[model samples]
Target: MITRRMLLGTMVAAPAAACAHSLTEPEYPRVGAVERLDPRLDAIIAPDAPIEVLATGYSWAEGPTWVDRGGYLLFSDPPNNVVHRWQPGVGAAPFLKPSGLAGPIPAAVREAGANGLDIDRQGRLVMADSGTRAIARVDLATKQKTLLATRYQGKRFNSPNDLVISRTGAIYFSDPPYGFSAFDESPLRELLFNGVYRLAPDGSVALLDDSHHRPNGIGLSPDERTLYLALSDEKRPQVLAYSLDAYGMPTGAPRLFLDMSEGLAAGRPGLPDGLKVDSAGHVFATGPGGVHICTPEGDLLGIVATGKAVANCALGGPNGRDLFLTSHDMLARVRLSRPA
Candidate 1:
C-alpha cells in the first residue's frame, strides 16, 4: 500500500538549512539531466529540462499511457501485477490490482502482468496482458477486461510485451519470451520465434515479422506510413523501421533506425524498451542511457537520461508537452518543447 505521496515525502526529507536553493528550485527530486547531442535538440527540449522523479519503488515499471479523458497517466508494474494511475495534483495510486492474471500465479511465468498499454480510438484501455499471453481491452468504468487475441495460427503467444494502435483500429504488438522464467527455452513457450503481429479489427491476427530475437517495444510514425520496432537483444540493441502498405501491413523488410550498441558498451543501464512518436514525427525511444530523442530521419538529437533503466514513456499533460517516464524502480517526467 505504498503510495507516491509517501515515497515523495521520504525522497524530499532534506533539511531546508542544509540544502538551501534559489526561487528556481525544482518541485520534485530530479535524478538525471538532459544530454544534448545535436544543436537541434534545443528546439525539442529546454536547455534546463530536469528528469523529475515522481515516484519510487516499483517491481518493474513499464507501459506508460496518457489518459487524455481523465487527465491522468496509467502505467504497469509487471512484476507486482498492478496498474498505477498518476494525476498531476493528487499523486500516484493503484488503479487496478491483479492487473494481468486473475487466477493463481503460474509457475511458468516470471512476470505475470501487463507490459504495455494504450488507449484505443474508442478511449478504452488496450493492454498487452503478459499473464494471459494475450492482447486485451479494459473497460475503465467497471474494470472489466475483454480478451481480444490470444493465439496466432494455433499456438499461444510467448508473451505480448508492447503494442500500438493505428487510427483504423488495428493493434500492432510484439511478443517475446520475457514473461517466461527460462525465456525462449521455457517449456511453456509455444512460438518458436519472437514476433511482431497485427490484430485486425475483424479479430484476425497476422504475423508481421518473426526475425527479431526479442522485439520489445512497438510504435507507429505520425504519418502512419511506417512502423517502428525496438529489439531488446543485448548484443544488437537497436530500433527498426518498416514501410507499411496501404492495407496497414508491412510492405518490405525493416531498415535500421537507431543503434544503441555504443551506448550499451558505455554501460548505460537500459535496453531499447518502449517508444512514442510526437505529433511532429520526432521519435522518443527508451534505450541504453535513457530515452533517446531522434528526428524522423533517425538523427540523434538528445537523451533524457534517467540514471536508471527506463522502461517506457508517454506524452501527456494539460498541454501535451510532458514526457512521462517509467524508469526501472520509479516514475519520472520531463517537459518537452513539442506536443505528442
Candidate 2:
C-alpha cells in the first residue's frame, strides 16, 4: 500500500458539482505505523509497510469483509444504516442503503445497521444485524435479505454484533446490547445476559457462553478447533479462546489467549474489538493500541497502530494478503507478507 495526497487534493480542488467520473487506483494518504515488538513479525508483515487510507467520513464503521469474486471490500457504517463498498481503483461507494434498519429505529437505539459480515460456504453474505437483532443472509446479486435467527427461547436477542461461519455450515456469533442507547440498561434489550451463540445447520441456536459482559468479535482457528472471542469490556479487556468439538460446539471452558489490561493501563486508544485468524494461525486482533498481531500461543509480535480506534478488519485482495481495517471514520489497508 502506498500513500497519495494528490487524489484527495484533486477532489478538494474540484467544484461542488464537478466530481471526477473516471475510475482509477485512488492512492489515499497514509497514517499510522507498523510497530514491531518481535523479530518474528518480519515473516508476516513488512516493517516499513504503509497503512494506506481507503475511505473516510464514516459514522462508526465496522464489519469489514472482502468479496473475492467481486474484487472489492464491503464495510458497515452502523449509525448511518449503510454498507459501503471499496475498490482498488474506485474508492468507496454505498453498496446497500438502509443496510439494516428499514424503518424508523427505536428511540433508544444507538446503532441501527449491520455490524459484522462474512461469506458463508454458499457464498452468500451473512450478517450480524444489530438493527433487526438477528443473523441474516444477503444475496449479493439481488440484495435480498433473509433473517436466519432473531430470538432464542422466545425472547428477542439484545443485538447480534459479530459472526463467523464454520466449514460445516454452522454460524457462530456474539450478542451484546451496543445497539441500545443505554446498552444493558436500555428498555429495548430483551436478553438479560450478553451471550456467545452458535447457529447450527439445522436452524438450532445454542448458547456457548453468557458470562461475558460484552463479546464483540468472533473468529475461528484455521483448524476450527478453537474459537477466539474479543471482549470489548474495558474493565477486563482481553481475548479468550475456547476449545471446540468436531461438531463445532464449545467443549470446554475458555482460556485466556491474550490479556490487554497492560495495554489499556498503558493508555492505548482501543479495547479488544474485532479479530481474524490467518491460515498459519496468527491472530490479528483489533485491541488496545490498534491491530495486535499475535501467535496462536498468545504472544504478541507486532501492532498496526492506526492512531484511532479500529473496529474491525478483514483479509482480502488478489491473494488474500491485504489487511483491510475499519478504523473509526476511516477505512485503511496494509499489505501483508503472509496471506490469511
Candidate 3:
C-alpha cells in the first residue's frame, strides 16, 4: 500500500535529471504514438499530426484551459502553486503566483494549488482551488477573485477538484481528497464521502452522486443530456456516464462508459482523471497511458499516448482544433483534423 508520504513524494519529487535540466524547454523529443482503433478517428485526428512538446519542468502540471479572447493557454502546476500561460509567438510564463493557497501554510504541505479551470459564460475564469477548498472565479479585467461555493449542508468541503459549467450558468464539480496532504486520512476532511455536486443558478448546492470512490474529472455532453465523470481509483479506474433530465438532475442508473482494469493490471501509468467532450460527442478522457478517445456510446476509438503520465487536456486554438495536454512535467499540443 502506498502511504501518504510515499504518494506525495511520488507526485512532487522531480527526477534528478529533470531537476538538473532547465524548465524553459523539453528534455525529450516531441514524439508519441497514436493508436487508431476505428476509421472515424481519422476524421478527427490527422494521421500525420505530431505531438509537440511546448514546455517542461513542472511538479505535476494539470488543469489546462484555453482563453479564446486572449488566444492563450493557461494551466496549473499544483505543487509549485503557480499558474502559467502559453501563447503562439510568446512562450510560457507565470500568470499567477500563490495561485491556489493564498495565506500562510505549513512548509511541509504539498499539492496545495488550483486543479481544474474553465471560462464561464461571463468570460470570468472559474477555478477549482484545492488549496482554498472552494470554487472561485477570477475576473480577468479586474483581477478580482470571488468565492462561488465553499460548503455543502454547512460542512466544509474536502477539496473542490474539477468542474464544468452549463449553458444555464449552473456549475458541476467534484469534491475529492487529493488536495489534502494525507488524502483521505487527512484531519481536515469533513464530508463522509467524496461527492459530485451541482451548484444551480438559483444559488443552491445539490449532491449529484457520492458513489464514486475518488471522483476527479468531469464533463458534460454537447447536448447537455449526459454527464461524464472520471473516477481516479487505481483499483477501480473507470469513466461513468449518467443521463440528465431537463432540470440537469441525473436520471436512472449510470452506465459504465469505459474501464481501464486491464491496463492498470498491466502497470499503465495513470488512472481516469480529467475528461472533455467534442461537438461530435466524442469523449477525450485522460487515462491509462494518455488520452482515450471514445464515442458517446463508450466505444473506444483511439488513444493519444504522450509517453508520460498526462493529467488533463483542453481543446482550443484559432479554430478550437488544437489539443493542449498537461503531461507530468511537460506541456504538449497536437492538432486535430476537426475543430473541437
lDDT winner among the candidates?
1
lDDT of 1 by residue, 86-162 (tens): 76755789998888987798787878989899998777899999988999999877788999999999999998999
Model number with the top TM-score: 2
lDDT tens digits by residue: candidate 3, 14-81 = 34223323334334357687788788889889656789888888988889988766667889987788
Candidate 1 residue pairs in backbone clash: none
lDDT of 1: 0.86
lDDT of 2 by residue, 72-137 (tens): 778998889899887676678998888887888879987899999998866688999998899999
lDDT of 2 at 64: 95
Q: Rate the local accuracy (lDDT) of all candidates.
A: 0.86, 0.86, 0.82
By summed lDDT, the worst window of 10 consecutive residues in model 2 runs over 2-11
Q: Determine which window of 10 residues in candidate 1 has minimal summed lDDT.
A: 3-12
Candidate 2 C-alpha RMSD relative to the actual structure:
7.5
Residue pairs of candidate 3 with colliding backbone atoms: none
What pairs collide in candidate 2? none
Question: What is the descending lDDT order?
Answer: 1, 2, 3
